[model samples]
Target: MIPELCDQRIRQFINGSDFVLAMNEDNHVFSWGDNHCGQCGRKATPFRVYLKPEVISDLNDKNITHICCGFKHSLALTTDGQVYGWGSYYEQYQNAEGSDTRVINSCENHYKSFFEELSDNPIGSGGFGTVFKVRHRFDEHIYAVKRIHKEDEIKNHMEVKNLVKVRSKYVVQYYNSWTEGIILYIQMELCEYNLQNILEVKLQVFGRQLGEAMDSVEYLISCEIFRQVLESVQYLHELNPQIIHRDLKPENILITLGKAMDCVEYLISCEIFRQILESVQYLHEMNPQIIHRDLKPENILIAENIRNGRFVKLCDFGLATVHDKRVHYRTTQKHTADVGDMRYIAPEVSQGGKYGHKCDIYSLALIGGNIFEIDLFNLELEDTNVYSELYQILNEPVYRLQTILISMFRTRLWHRRPECSEVLSEYNEWSIDRNILANDTRFDGILSILQSNDNHLFIELSAIGSGGFGTVFKVKHRFEEHIYAIKRVEIKDESEEYLQRFYNEVKNLIKVRSEYCVQYYNSWTEGNILYIHMELCEHNLQNILEVKQQVFDRKLGKAMDCVEYLISCEIFRQILESVQYLHEMNPQIIHRDLKPEN
Candidate 1:
């Protein structure tokens, strides 16, 4: 009875026009439901109640391994890692004849012959269509072949054309495509796995629990991973043609294992972020804007592991679109089916309104929130229900944290959230502050001392110099027998900007430890005066120059040589390297007051 039922179901599947199936072990084809573009792969009958399974000639004898179906397109994979596709071809071509041998050709051919050779076989399938793994006949190298049903040939062609122009570490590379009978086949690089697989592994390792036993190190590593992913998305959104990976989900993201923890760390190092930013910036400057309508994890691919299992490559551009105001494609009237996944779709997208890169920002925040299991949109206010839960998890003051979280998850499209550039800046600031507080005990202790001292300590130092914002004095530490430079600043009591700048300067200088730049030893506030202690150098470059003009003596030349020698020293080399590092920073900051003296 079971065998009979199974056979009946198989027959029904084969006879149904809406159902389309491809078998790996045997190239068996089944169809049911809809068959608008002959998707059933069956010949049209004069009068029939249902369509019967028709064996595809091109796929016969091929050891099929996988099958993918787009809305109307179909793709098949073979054991030899070759991809074969069948579907509609909306692209038009012109056939012209040369009257004479010497006649010049005016019209160039835009289309290539279809299914002339089989290089790779299909391995995976997706919403837009199916993918195959093909091997080069001569070198036997493997590749991923993608076939879009003719129903989606135009959009697929545009995606392929756009992807070909942009070069990014997060994007998949497009190869070539052609038409065979009724199908269109596009071959591309064969990637390993998607991001979904990696997250699943992580979830399993953690016992499939959302927020259990997750440590600081794990969170830190995850934060770094999120940073890299955003950098890639930002790069795509910034492209000239401005390609957006509208569908960016974990399944589309790929990951590989590495040998050591540091390997992954190096893969997601600051240097890599710079590279990603530059690429995104280049994309943003393109002529036509590209918006990735779907920015979910499934659309991201993890091609390989960089640095021995430390970093991953992002892939999948099936739902990517160009955001061009001047060149608008009638998507509403034409292909009206829902475009994005339900989980990561932006609010604006869900409401059927137009969106730009900010939509990507919302999706990115969602991705971050999911990984951290922290809601970035709704702030945990004292009056809100989630406040107690948030307090328990963070174990710190929730007001400021709530403010930051609320600012991140604003609902209005334009006013709702900060730009990618801004988010990166905030992350950098927070990261630097955290590093300073964690690493510098003296500075941390100074904050405590300032809180207790109030108006106790008095400055008893000689004023040595003054600058635009503050004054520097050489003084003795009241309690310790140490001489230090105290920089005092006077600002309006209510000026948070001034206070922030002062603290930022201290933090920036302290975080920076290079021989070329003066280092921050300590900083404190007493009464109304803010004091910053820094390493004291004997002479400024301007003073040295003045001294040189006074006398060109042997001693002066030796002094200049000594200064030059110090600059040439390995320690000074490190200083120059540090300065270069600062210059290469994101947002490209410049030290405007780079003269010899502050």
Candidate 2:
């Protein structure tokens, strides 16, 4: 038994003039021995011998059912009734149809019979190849035909092979591929435009300005487009042999348009940063991680989806790299430095050091900053001075986003940076805090818990107040029927420092024993949220003052009534006494949240 065929379990063997073809139990084909005239389906010259069997990887998924060999030639038959032949039997394959064999030949005459070029001028041209508009003779449907000049005789080009392996709604669809003369032709789904065109149109509308930020509507559309792109990347990263789109720029991504909808509204706010991080998270989580070393805005494409409106298609995998499994962390070593655009490449990559999937996260942060028009100066600098310009122009939301971006741009301290999954989680919470998903149906399950349930002790009456820390709800005990206030604070950060602050607040509440102070009855933790039950007050200081103003209007202040003045003095005295009581504690507890609403 041949050692190479031992693992695969050889099912059948056929002999050529000086070579041998073996069919495995899995329907895979392997060839070896004399490879003269390419009978072995491998690159070889006359009399060249392959002592060990080499897999014909091109036909791995063909489900080859039978193999036949002729003098200096070979052929394989697949279960789907298709025939594939290579080597010296060129002329005989012309009449292969007569024998009921559908040959996957790509000769000049065969290509002309199947596809017809529509125009003399090429539709698009890039580093990979030149694209032309072509129509299938039988189906009469137009397709984008990419004609790549044969530079390498490696059977399959990287882009074509990657495209054939990927099947995603957000990726450009591959139809067919063939070789004609010295050119490789690939048929793909046609798109009207690319993301660059959209950006150009937006720039034109803004009078060719560069730094102008997109309005909320345009930003939302951009977010939707990026959401699909992230999903496509996630799909690639989840593949058995993970794929990385080494060249992730705008030009590679194509756009398709759909019918215009009337008065459409977006209920869920799209967090492009979060979506991007989620995609990268998948890549980093793989056993042998994949890294998209080249990631920029140019690689992102906008496409139309029938069910979801405008979406993004992530294209171009020419530079994607999978990690070497030999490494402990599955990181790639000796990667080509200065491979991607200077603006988006990570410091570790540009500096020619060992890097992992975190490099992609760095690129993602740069792209996120670009989408929001956040300027990142000297991104390689390990200081907040890189964000000095951002502080001057950005508002609160942008400020928070840039802070996250800065964490990703950790320069040489990349290990200290948060993982893509952590970044995504932070952004998810950010979206919720912004009330973007206030009406989102997905949150209905959590909101439903506010009603009387077996897990909860009280039934919520109403939302009394809400602030950055938590939301206070008026609730009645299910068994006791006593009204009380319950403050529910989501536990976003589980760090000891954050939890210590929360515990300290609870401690202070337990220690205080004053009639003026809100009495804390009990506290508990459930599902990443802290719940505190306290004595319910009829009105807060602000509510009482507002009601008093409405009752007297302008008359009370100007007329200076004695009864109203005395009531206001008593309220002020109580507030001062509460503050005094807290300060007089052994370890004085300062009420930081002392606003009127509190």
Candidate 3:
């Protein structure tokens, strides 16, 4: 067996003869062994000793996303899309320092004075100091002012640095930060409602509904919130420093309304949820990686009257830190930081055992469970024993899907936990197949659009194909004992006129059954999502063609554009028969779109 390397924190490294360089998850390049030519992005002096891991501060603001160490020179790729070089420069390292600045005009409409507030009741205050809602005089745009006390300056500089570095819709934006000797003033985007307040409101209104299954509306709302939080954390992990929000609680996040939604299109929330999962999926798949040690309900923000909470964002990076994301398995050494929320902290994190991104996954699972039970938002539990709720979440069957998700976080064992991407995939899917199944299930090999016992009757598996209109998934029905492909078509417009056309097409599809054509088994619509089940084929034409190409290459010693004469003849014959069958219908049916996939 290969031995595991102790250098788990290094994102990537390059070895060279004279010197060896390593870049950590924090995006700081560490050079050691030898630095004969100042290849480590540092100044050379007569008594300079080239040794252990030292940060290349010049590339700090650039937020270097990637790095490449050359024999005589090194390249630092920043997140801003600019490339900085150091070492045996093409002009001595291309001066990777202040070259990043592109000066703006003398008088930009940016928030310059956050210190001066028109009306100061003060919005909120904490260890960071008081925050007040402020408006710029020139632009007349409203902004939030976070006034940090003078004593906290030296200690909180890193947090200030992170705010200025990151720019994301989910994360609160930073406008300007300044120090006036005694105090530090920061101008940032204003969030009207904090997540903690929103959670309380949500619980107060929807607490009674916990016993019943969440409707499409509630599911979509929760999903959107979950997605944004994961995405924001993912963004922080991808940064050069690979930040982890150690204090991810709802009180830290803020929400704003961006758009207005009408009464008709609540299903559009489906799209919003997908966008969130995609962003988070990108985060879990990062190299060095990021794990938010603090992931609780308080960190999740929801926008009010904004498309029914469509535009949510994650905020608060107070206890955020750049950790060694490269480390996978827990180390023998214990981490004794009381950083995260007590209820949501992963066992590994709580026990001081070394952990990774899965810790964030655990926290998110707890948050999801708490949100489902409405226990996460209720302020009454703040003074009461929260452990009972955590215990119930662990033992009770209140959240079936959440129980499955929370299983990952029950122990300190890293191998037991699911990745963020996996959780996102399963959660984003429609799990209320039972409700749909209750409506119908009279069909055969094509499982009924919705069988009476849908959960037991059929299982929707992996995706087969995707198109502009819909996506197709490979599925199997337990009763039918046959594999089938189901197409989930998106309803473009919710009107009888458009729906009638779909019904007519389905009616036509059902009647013209033939050996030469794909056998259509079922068709149905539930809400906006549509389903069309059909017979599963051995292979698609593309796969068949590729296999045939490989065979021809071996036998004939040359690649052929088309298949063999006899095989091509059979394919053409089948195609013609299918076309003929379609044409012979009552009113000749014409397929406007025809390709290998079809």
Residue 30 accuracy (lDDT) in model 1: 45
Backbone clash tally (model 2): 8
Q: Quote model 3's TM-score.
A: 0.30
| Best first by lDDT, ranked | 2, 3, 1
Assess the local accuracy of residue 412 in candidate 3 as a C-alpha lDDT between 0 and 100.
36
TM-score of model 2 (CA atoms): 0.34
Compose the digit string of candidate 3's lDDT tens values, residues 127-158: 87888877666555567878787775566677
Q: Residues 17-117, candidate 1: write the lDDT tens digits.
A: 24465442234444443444444454432223344444454443333556766554455665444565443322331124311121111112112222222
Q: State each candidate's clash count.
A: 73, 8, 8
Each prediction's RMSD to truth:
28.9, 27.6, 22.6
Clashing pairs in 2: 248-299, 249-298, 249-299, 249-300, 250-297, 250-298, 250-299, 251-298
How far is 259's C-alpha from truth in model 3 (Å)?
6.0
**What is the RMSD of candidate 2?**
27.6
TM-score, every prediction: 0.26, 0.34, 0.30
Task: Report the error of model 2 at residue 109, Å.
Answer: 3.5
Question: After superposing candidate 1, which stretches have Cα over 4 Å from the reference?
Answer: 1-122, 256-598
* lDDT, residue 559, model 1: 52
For candidate 1, give the lDDT of residue 123. Answer: 53
